[model samples]
Target: MVGERSKQAFERAKRVLVGGVNSPVRAFRAVGGTPYFADRGEGPYLYDIDGHRYIDYLMSWGPLIWGHAHPDIVRAIAETAARGTSFGVPTELETEMAEEIVELVPSVEKVRMVSSGTEATMSAIRLARAATGRTAIVKCIGCYHGHADSFLVKAGSGVAALGLPDSPGVPQSVAERTLTVPYNDADAMEKLFADRGDEIAAVILEPVAGNMGCVLPLPGYLEAVREITRRYGSLLIFDEVITGFRVGLGGAQARFGVLPDLTTFGKVIGAGLPVGAYGGRKDLMALVAPEGPVYQAGTLSGNPLAMAAGLTSLRMLKRAATEGAYDRLESYGRRLVEAFCQTASHCGLPATGHAIGGMFGLFFHSGPIVDFETAKACDQALYADFFHEMLAEGVAFAPAQLESGFMSMVHGEAEIEKTIEAMERAIPRIAARRR
Candidate 1:
């Protein structure tokens, strides 16, 4: 229930905020309802303004891996804020954060911090262009690499959620430089590269394809992309902004044994704070300015509070990994998706799901959902009904079917049971509506 208070809040926000929300998806446009305003979150539960508590599977869109308001991250942010939030000068905290990332991620030899995923990706493309001396970049259709102009041509997530084909402001010439191929289709990528290999500077993709739901790479798909990019003399850039630390300790690169020339990261690395990073081969990173020619600078790139929170979160994850926390997370996701699919089937509604580490997707369609084309074929109306009913059952999934559901370390067995119980009840009722 988005209570009267939240409704009023939205009404008030509409006077000041664009579409009554800072982000388009948050407005609940895709789900066809007013959004509930979150008051606070604790562990895996979010409390809304109406005093409703829901088990949060969205987890702030995949950043709250340890769940909300974890004491460690909060304390880190508070302590670093006391020291000062930003100085416009580099801090040792930033260096330590960089070292932690370089140590953990297989593809990154050196890193440059930025304030947002968009910054990391935009800067990465610039560096790729400068290093390869080519203007064209290749990206997968429906694989979102942030909101950088070049990436919006065939983006997913909010762009798909809002039903926008492509944004208006990006120049056609800029769009032309960004070649798009269907995800999980190695031959399409190969054909494109074969046709215009010399014009391509880089091939960028979400290694796990989180944007168009939690789509996995086809067997040998990532390796094929890597081989093609290498053969074509184009850089391979993995946008791990959503999957970075969430999928595994070393990200998709370490998990899949495929390394890219450059990697971009966000979400879990910042521990619910605003931060992003791009790093890879030392020679390529050397091209970023102050050390080389490609110019990219941000005042809050390495803000102490973000660095502290991120470092604390990473250290926590690293320790937890040693204790099989990630294994448990993967298990939780698997169990939940299995339960969701089973329940949907029992209710005589077709459904499919995939769970990889802490990320999962539930689709109202029979699936071997390999790419965006298949992903878009899911039942949007059924999902929207299921979302609202699940809300009524006191569980929170992503507002739209296109988004991925995240599991946190704090989503214990009890929470998992609670969610399944909610789904068992919600699914049949929603399915009945569809019938």
Candidate 2:
């Protein structure tokens, strides 16, 4: 049950905000309860309105690698704000942030900052089409690249959670220009390019799919896509909005040793601020203005506050990486996965999961949740029940099954242990209800 204050707050919000929230998934539609309003977050825990606390694995949808309101990040933002928020002209802080991205990401050489992930991806596709002289693009099914018109077809995340595969407002011709293929299926990708190779400006993907429940690429899947794109003279775009810096210091491309032509980043780079970026080979990025004609611009492209906070976060990550911090996050995620799997097994219910670096997924399916079709086949109702039970136990997973669960540097042994115990208690009750 939701606390009264949160319930009241939601009712008040519904009169003004769309669906009582800006985002659809926050309505808790999948879980069938009043969404708890967050009051404050500290370290690994989020305190909700009406005074409920949970060990938060949501991690603000994969940005808070150092955890909520981290002192360094907060101080950096405060110091930057004292100076100024935004300037119509350029700032050195933007350059510093771009330099860090270029250094850390495997594919990015020259980058352009934007206001949101949607902007980063939308601009990347536009540049790709201009460079290739083609208007068509390919995107992995269930791999969301923000809410761009070209990406709304067969998208995931909130769109999928809301059960709207393709939104209404996007035109039919626009949707048709965006081709789709099942993720982790190189053969499907090869086939698509074989038929429409000349038309495809680029193939955009989440190298490690986050929106479709943290799905990992099949072995050699990324490599095959890279080869196909190279042979066809098409660019490969890795949508690393979730995986960048969260999966590793250099991201999934570094982890898997496959480099795309262009990469888009958001969540971790801004450290939870509303920021995004797209970068690629110098020659390609050279085509973007004021260097060339394919124009995309934002007044808040490099807001100083975002730059300062992100710079501080990335710098801290660089130090933490030296201390094997990413490995620790992976280990912690694996423990939660193990606990969830073990309890489901004890209850004779189907369960499977995967954890990589700082991201994990819990599925109410037996095994091998490779793509959207398989992921959707999982027992969603059962997941909804389990979700609420865990919430009651003070462990907050993503509100829906298709979204990824995030781990943070702040979540330690104690939090992990308590979460495991919570799962142990919650799953059995859910199982009993099913029986």
Q: What is the TM-score of each candidate against the true structure?
A: 0.99, 0.99
Give the clashing pairs for model 1: none
Pairs of residues clashing in candidate 2: none
Per-residue CA lDDT of model 1 for 48-104, tens digit only, reads: 999999999999999899999999899999988998889998899999999999999
Model 2 bad stretches (over 4 Å): none
Q: How high is the CA lDDT of each candidate model? A: 0.93, 0.93
lDDT by residue for model 2 (209-246), tens:
99989899999899999999999999999999899999
Q: Which stretches of candidate 1 lie over 4 Å from their true place?
A: none
